[model samples]
Structures are given as C-alpha cells and as structure tokens.
Target chain A: MLRLFKNKFFLLLLITVFIFILMGVTAKQNSKLNWFSNTINVIFSPVEKFFSGIGDKIGSGLSYFGDVKEVKKENAKLKSDIDKLEKDTADLERYKQENDRLREALNLKNQFNQYDSIGGNVIAKDPGNWFDIFTVDAGTKDGVGNNYPVIAGSGLVGRVLNAGFISSKIMTIIDVDSTVSGMLTKTGDQVIIKGDLSLKEQGLCRMDYIPTDEDISVGDSVVTSGIGGYYPKGIFIGKIKEIRQTNNEFTRYAIIEPVVDFKRLEEVFILKNKNVGNTGTDGAGK
Target chain B: MKARNIVFAVSIFIIVVLQTTVLHYIKIFGITPNIMVVVVIGIALLFGNTQGAIAGFILGFCQDITFGKMLGFYALAGLYLGLVVGIVNKRLYRENILVIIFFTFISTIVYELSVYLVHEWGMHLFSPENSNNLDILYAVRNITLPEAIYNSIISVPIYALMIRINDRFENANKSIRKY
Candidate 1:
C-alpha cells in the first residue's frame, strides 16, 4: 500500500475515482457547484465574436451577387401581376402557418404571464458527446429556473438544467434524460417522448407505450400533452421520424423529428412557468 | 519553471476558447478536430506525467466548464490520457515528429472513446428510454473519430514547439551548471 502511493499512475486513478464517487453522492444537492462553466462562457465571448465576423464576411460575399440579381428579378416579377399573385399566395400561405404557430404560442404565453420570460441567444453547444445539452445566455437573473421550458419558433427545445446570473444551460430535447409527455395531435393518443442525444442534429425524439391499434401514420404530428408539469399542452413537438414495431413487443415505438431546427437554433424564449395548469387559460383549447 | 508553467496555462486557456468557438467552423464530416486534447497529449509527452496530468485536468476541466457538462467528466478523462501517455513514454523514443504524430493519433481515439463510454453509461443510468435507441457506432464515426484525427494532425506542430521549449530549458540548465 505504501509502495502504491509512489506510483503516480495509480494515484491519479485513485483520485479520479474518488472525485467520481464524491460527485455521485452530491449530484442531487445544490452545493457551491461549479461557476467555472458560466465563467468559461464569458471568457469565450470574444472567440464567438471572431467567428461571427468570419461568418458575416462569407455571407456578404455570397449574397453580393444575389443582391444585384434579386433587384432585377424583383422588377421582372413585379411586371406580371398574375405571376406575382401566385408568389404572393405562396408567401401568404407560409405566413398563415407562421401566424397560427405564433397565435398558439401567444395563447400559451398569456397563460403564464406571472413568470417572466427571458430571451437569450444560444452561445455554445454541448462541449462533447458525453452530454446532449446546450448553454444559453439567460440565467437566474433572467428569471430562468431549473426545468424551465425553452421554445423556438417551432416548438420545444428542452428545459433549464443549470442557470446563472446572465446565462443558463438547457438540456436539449435530444438528451436522454429529458421526458416530455406528448400526444398524437391528430389522434389524441398520449405517449412519452424521450430524447436521442445521439441523433440530436436529426432532431430525433422517441415515443413509447404507443398502442399498436392507434392510427399513427408516418406524418402524424406530436405535441405536448401538458401532463408533464413543465411543458404546456398543444406545443408542436415533431413529426414521427420512424417507427420500429416488433412482433413480440406489446407497445410500439417511433422516432420523432423535432419541429425546431437544431442546427440553426439561435435565439430562444426561456419559459419560466413550470406549472402549466395554474396559469389562466387551458392550453388545450378550441 | 514557473514562467514556463504559467505560459502553458495561459496558452491552453486561449486555445480552448478558439477550439470551441472558432475551430468549430473547420468541421469536416461532422467532426471538428479537438485542438485542446492534442495539446494536452503533446504537453504530457514533453513534461512527463505530473505536468501532463495537470495540463490535461485543467484543459478538460475548462472544456467541461465552458460546455456546461457534468463537472469533471473531461478532466478525469484527460488526466488518465496524460498519465497513460507519460508512463508509456519512458520506454519509447518520442524525439521524432512521426512518433509524436502517432502518439496524438492513438491518444485522441483513446480520449474520445473514454468520454463516449462515460456518456453512454451515464445516460443509460440517468435515462434508460433515451439510451436504448442510440446508434453508438454512427455517433462515433460522425462526431468522435474524425475530430480526434483532425486534432491529432494539428498536434504535430504543437508537439514540435513543446519539444523546442524543453530543449531551451535543458540548454539553460546546462549553462548554469557550467558556470
């Protein structure tokens, strides 16, 4: 035992194991915890700015020609009202969809005005493959709390995992630990959605305990059932990505593609309401 | 020694910020090379296990802190990688650039694999429903291995610089002894 101390290899391993054990024990409690994660975000802000500059340069270069072409194209298209009307119809259709989504979201938002909502940009991604989470610019000072739902234009992102003064970390919908109660929007069949962080960029979530007899087609949409205290009902979750139905299995499962585009995720709204019920209007409405 | 140590710490801090926010742009096939991991391995080879482990722990800790992960995951992974590399280095001649390159190549894989395993197992325990559906091999190929390889290549120049620093320190010590 004395000689083992001399081996730095063994010593390092021992220390790591001890730390792991200690972390496991206190994982539940909110100790001093680590502020270094938040500190790193602040330190890395300049780096993000540098990249954003490069992105702007590249974007401007590519769009310069398109900008010139677009002016002429806009004039030509404006000359023909019939063609212009068709284009306007398509645009109007898209706008209607957008309007409806926002309308639903606004209705949901009105239910929880008691709690403040913080708007923040996603500053960084989950560092490595070990976790499927994200770091955002909102924190405790922003009124964001643990398990606060984050939403984009589409629907759900995840919930607040760790929050600071100016920023908070979100465990994305792709993370394995996240479980959102959702239902088939067309059929009203309740199911539990789990995140596949492994396939995060694909925006995949898994649905379990789905009845075999249910009419769950490939394109059937999923939405939060509001059974879970965190996410309010009627928020669009995703379309069914894939289905794996085994003969022996009693309950079928399907992979869902989240409505939010994870790759282009930037600014998101951090919802402060954990209790979706106590809020004024029922989210599931006519 | 103190000045050199401080330089290592400062350089690593700068590199990590660049690695996460800047180098993320250099992604090829969904894996952005991990510059910090390679740097840790390079430093470990030059300074031996104690310094190597220290560097690894700090760098990995920095990654975890910045990325908002479960604390100490990267730190422990890095510490072990550095120790293993440092210990094996005693029996091998790492003076050649090819040797350093090879070291980086192998160590990166080791580092990534360790992290991935911990992640899967941890997720399995924390959320079993999410764990059963993952394509582990695809995840590694798309996101893990390529980044490791890219970082390994990047570490070649960095390891050469580390060797140069070591040489300068040894030369200074020799001059002092002669005086």
Candidate 2:
C-alpha cells in the first residue's frame, strides 16, 4: 500500500475516489455544508452575477436592431393607430412590461399567499440549451435553502439546488432530474411531471402515470399537487402539448410545455415557505 | 510554482464564470460547447499528469459549485479525465493539432457519459417509466456528440493559450536559474 501510494496514478485515483465517496454520502444534505463549495460560491457568485448583468446588457445591445425592426413592423400593422398613438406606443410598450411584472407579482403573491418570497436576478445558467439547471444571485443570506420552490412570472421555474451565502443554484423544471407531483387542472387527474432530456430544447417535460381513464387530453393544465411537501399546492406547472401512449398502455405520458421560457428568463422568485420539509435537487454534469 | 498555480486557478475561475454567464447565451446545434473541458484538456496535454489532474479537479469542483447541487461527481469525473488524458497524451505528440482534437473529443464524451451514468442513471431502477424509455442514444446524439465537436472547435485557441503559458512558466524558471 505504501509503495502503491508512490505511484502517482494510483495516488490520484485514491484521492478522487475518497472525495467522491464523501460527496455521494452527503449529496442529500444542505449543499452549503461543504466549506470548499461554499467558498467557491461566495467568490464566484458575485463575479457570475456581474457577468450576467453584462450578458443581459450585451444581449439587449446586440438585439437592438432586431427590436427596431419589430417596432417598425408593428408600426406598419397599426399604421392608422400609429399616427395618433406613435408617441404613446413607446410608453405603452414600457407600461406593458411593467404591467406584466406587476401582474405576475400579484398572481404569485395571491397563489402562494402562505409562502414568503425573495426575488433575485438570474446571474448565470447552464451553458447548454437545456435549462435543467442554472445559478441565481440570491443565497442563504436571503433565507433560500434546499428544495425551495422557484417561480418566474406566473409559471413554476424550478427549485433551489444549493443555497450559498450569496448565491443559489436552481434546477429548472425541464431538466431530466426534476420530478414534480402535478394534477390535471380540468379533470383533477394526478400525474408525475418530470423534465425530459429529449424535449428539453422545446422547453417541455413529460407527464408520467396518466391513467387511461383520467379524462386527460391535449391542452390540459398541470399544477403542483403538493404531495411531496417540498413544493406547496397549486403552483402552475405547465400545459399539456401532446400525449404518448406506449405499447404497455400502462406507460402513458404527456408532453407538457413549461410556461417559463428558459431562453428569455432573466429574473426569478424563490419561495420561502415556513411549512416544508427538507428535500434535495441535483443536476447532471454538462 | 506559486505563480503557476495562481495562473491555473485564475484561468479556471474566469472559465467557470464564462461557462455560466456568457457561454449560456451562445449555442450551436442547441448546445454550448463545454469550455471547461477544452481548458482542462489543454492543461492536461501541456502540463503533464500532475497539473492536469489538479486542474481538472478544481475546474470540476467549481463547475459543481456554480451549476450543480451535488458536489463531487463532476470533481471526480474531472480528476479522472485529467489523469486519463494527461497520461494518454504522454504517448502522443502535441505538435499535431489533430491529436489534441481527437483526444479532447473523446475526453468530453467520457466526461459527459460519466455524469449521465453517475447522476442520471444511478437512480434508474426507481423510475420504471424512465427505465423503459432508455435515452442513451438520444443523449449521445443530442448532447455528447454536439458537445464533442464544439469542444474541439474551442480547443484550438485553448491550445494556443496553453502553449504560451507553459512557455512563460519555463522561461521564468530558466531566468530564476540564471540569476
């Protein structure tokens, strides 16, 4: 064993294996428990948040011309109204966004009245097309913790993965690892809403365990059933886009398109509900 | 040695930020290249097994801290990848760009698969619905393959940066010896 330690290859393997074992055992705990991971989050979260700010600016800057073209196109569509409403159009557009935000806040506040929320800017995201996971600027200082339900606008975004001092990692609903208990709003059918890696690009998920006689169909809305105690009841999950009935017939599932557009998401809300148990969310390595 | 360590640490830090912030916006075939993989491959190919393993571990750990909740899966994958690639490159010459691209591509695939196996499929037995819908082929086609090509594309510039940094370290060592 002593001689084997001298072999650099074996030494590296031993070191990695030990760390992996330690991590695997603690994977379910508060992620901030690891000092090293916490320190990294502290150091990088701000830096990431800073870059994300710049990223948002740069994205808007680059798309400025596209926005202009859109305005021009809309101007043509409402040419008669444009003559009288041209100046107000700009203010109207601005108000439209503000109104949308206020409406979202109002809806979120009303729906999750029992839960308190800490709003944060989305600082960083997974590099890949899949929004299975991403990072946010808020952390433990903001009272966010593991498995806290996250929301954007009116839709269910995801849950908190790691809540650091200055930042938190969010696992988006469209990720393969996330599984939420959902109910079909119209028919009250219970099903499992899960992130499907296959449908990730389309910003969709798969609904599992749909009974053949649940009176479910395309366009049925799905919301959190609150069975797991991690997420509260009645969080809007998504709307069903399609259904896939397998040969087993027992393995029926539906494709759900998440309302939260992973592409344009810039900010999100982290819910701090008092009555919830500790649950863990983890994402795959890219 | 301290300065070299700082250089590696700083580069990985910047790469992690870019991976999450800037790289998030840029996508090819609906996926962004694994930039950290390119950086690790570059370090491994240029710096030897020791530095490669350490760099990979740090990079992987940072990635986990930034983008994931589970801490050490990526760290272990990175450490092993660095070691594997670093040792493998000992037999090949870095003068050939093709060799780096090929090896980097393979390394990226291995790393992606390791994550999928450890993180995704580890709980495969519990989710029977997912068990029947095997997605290895889908994952390979959609994620790993596109990422391999993307990593290779970025590996060229990372290789140049590695060569320059490696030379600087060697020159600094030489100057110290002369003094």
Candidate 3:
C-alpha cells in the first residue's frame, strides 16, 4: 500500500482528490484566514505596493505628457475651481454646525454618523480577471480586519475577505461569491444584491428576489440594509441600471451599476467595525 | 537551488505580479486573458512534472488566496492543471508556435471546465444563494470560450519567451562545462 501510494500518478490522484474535498471544506464563509497559510501576501506586499505605485504614476503621467498645454489650462481652471470649492466648503461647514446643534438639541443621533476608516492603496489584484478580488497595503497592522467595509469616493467598494498581518484581500461587490443585504433607498423595498459573473464585465451585479408587485425600476438607489451583521445599514451600494423578471419563485431581478469605478480603482478606504465604539470618522489619510 | 531555479521562481513571481497589476488595466471586450495560465502550461511542458507540479501547486495555492472563495479551490484546479498539462512533456518542440497554441487552447478548455465543475460542486455542498443559479453551460458560453480564445492568442508570446529562457540557461550551462 505504501509503494502503491509512492507512484507519481497515484500520488497526484490522491492529492487532487484530497484538495477537491478540501475545497468544499474551506468554501464556507470564515472570519479570518490564518496568516501562516498566507505568508505569500506578506512576502509580496511591498513589491506589489511598489509596482502599483509605479503603475498609477505611469497611468497619470502619460496623460500629462500627451498635452502639457491642456494640463496647464486645466491647472488654471482647477485653481479657480478650488477657490470656488473653498467658499462651498465654508457654507457646508456652517450648515454642518447648525445641523449638529439641532441634532444635539433634539438628542438625536447624526444620520450621517458612520464608522471611522483607515485608507489603503490597492497594491495588487487577483490574477484571474473574472472577479474583482484585490489586495490592499493596509492590514491588521493598520487596524483593519476581516469583513470590514471597503469604500471609495463614490460608494461601497467591498469588504475585507481576510486579513493577514500586513495585508488583506478584498472581495468586491461584483465578485460572484459576494452577497450583501440591500434595499432601495427610494422605496425601502429590500432585495439581495449578489455578484454574477455574466454581468460582472460591465461592473454590475444582479439584485434578486424583488417582489413582482414591488415598484422597483431603473435608477433606484440600493444601499446596505444592515440586516446581516457584517455590513452596517445605509452604505450606498449602487443604482439599478436595468430590471428583468426571472422565472424563479421570487420572479424579479435588477442590474446594479456600482458607483465605484472598479476599473480605475487605485485607493480605497476600509471602515472599522462600527460596534467597536471608536467612531473617530477620520478616513482620508494614507 | 541553482541559478536557473532562481530564475524560474523569479519568473513566476513576476508573471503573477504582472497578471494582477498591469493586466487588470488591459482587457479586450471586457475579458482579460490569463497570462499565468499560459505561463504555467509553458513551464509544465518545458520542465516536466516534478517541477511543474511544485510550481503549479504553489502558484495555485497563492491564487487561492488571491481569487478563491475557499482556500484550496483554485489550488486543486491549478495543481491538476499543471500535472495534466505536464503529461505531454517534451513531446512537442518548445520553439513551435503551433504547439504552444494547441496546448494553451486545450489546457484552457480543461481549466475552465474544471472551474465550472468545482464551482458547481462547492455550491452544491455549501449552500449558494441559489444553487440552481450556478449554471455551467452559461459560464462556458459567456466566460470560458472567450477567455480560452484570448489565452490561446496570448500564449504564443509567453511560450516564445519561455523558449528563449530555456535556450539562454542551456547555453550558460554549456559555457560553464567548457570552462
């Protein structure tokens, strides 16, 4: 039996079978991946970071070189735009103070109150292109953990799948395995927003199980319902692009066009779990 | 342990990094050709099974951490991909572009089928959102076929580079022997 196992073909077959079963075992949702099993991420984080930095520079620098005069003109326009934004910022600040005073007077919590987040630059991506899994430079070392919500300027990007000591993998909203509890902002009608590979090319998702009678339609805003303890309520998910009636029991689905531009994604903010009680709200640094 | 081994390992690392980083920005018709697959097949064909298996196993394991929902999902598929592709070792000339194209096309088909099968199986075992939604035929038509065609076109250059690498190392070894 030992000799039989020693044969290469037999050994390969055994190993393959073992891994196939192991795949099922490991397929279920887990909180954190062991760092020991994922030392490769640790080993390659810096190199990936360096290359990503260069890639970002190259992408931007090329456009700058194409037309220096255009950049100069844009620079002048941006400077004036910044001056205008400064005025807008001051007005918004005054409103924020007034709003805060009213909330405090009424003893009401700020509806815009959200968890504190630490930002990280996207260093590497999942080699396979079908799904939008990627890695970030931040990790447990940077106060991020598994299931922490990842976001960009426009909206929800994804959540941390697992955290290594120095790096973590993020499963984007459009990954086929990702399912988030979602509801329409306009109608409050709930639906399950999950990743579908077919629609992933367009950076879109399939929102399923909508009621036939539900008045859901194109352009409805979807956000996290916070039904699942994983993601907090009201994180902007995406807007519906198209709706289709499925033959399944629930019968209706919609396509979500994510607000985050996943194709050009370079940096992301990972929100700390809100229940931890340190809602500092400073999320715009490194 | 040898310099050639070091070169081979570094090549894998570089290819992986390139696949994830630069390749993310490069897509045609929203399909990104998997360069790692082509590289692994080329390595397996050139280097034979033990090296091929080890390379495939490590690459697959890393890929699991990268893209898989579970730990060993991509690892098992990658391991088998290398092993199966390695079986046709040294039979075809390394320099032949036609051989690279044929092997990449076939290997990609096999790889995609395995992904679909394992994905469906896993969804069956561990409850997917709607297990009925895991359609294998739909995946093949939409995802696999286009990727296979793209990889076949992309494999030619990677295999050519692999051939160049093999030649360079062999020549260096010959020079050392002469000394």
- Candidate 2 global Cα RMSD: 5.5
Q: Relative to the unseen true structure, what is the C-alpha lDDT of residue A225 in candidate 1, on a scale of 0 to 100?
A: 79
Question: Candidate 1 or 3, higher lDDT?
Answer: 3
Q: Rank the candidates by DockQ, best first.
A: 2, 3, 1
lDDT of 2 by residue, A19-75 (tens): 867676557654335666777688887888889889888888988867876887776
Which is the better candidate, 2 or 3, if ranked by DockQ? 2
The candidate with the higher DockQ, 1 or 3, is 3
Cα error, residue A58 of model 2, in Å, equals: 1.3
Residue runs of model 3 more than 4 Å from their true location after superposition: A1-6, A21-33, A72-114, A247-250, A277-286, B130-132, B135-138, B176-179
lDDT (10s digit) by residue, model 3, range A230-285? 66667789999998866655587889999998877879998885556232121111
CAPRI category for model 3:
medium
* Candidate rank order under TM-score: 2, 3, 1
Model 1 DockQ class: acceptable
Best by TM-score: 2
What tens digits encode model 1's per-residue C-alpha lDDT throughout A78-196? 78978879999999999988866865754444354455567888666654544567667677766666666788885888877766566676877777667788888666789988875
The number of the candidate with the highest lDDT is: 2
User: What is model 1's interface RMSD?
Assistant: 3.1
True contacts kept of 2: 0.76
Off by over 4 Å in 1: A1-10, A29-31, A35-115, A246-251, A274-286, B126-130, B133-136, B164-179
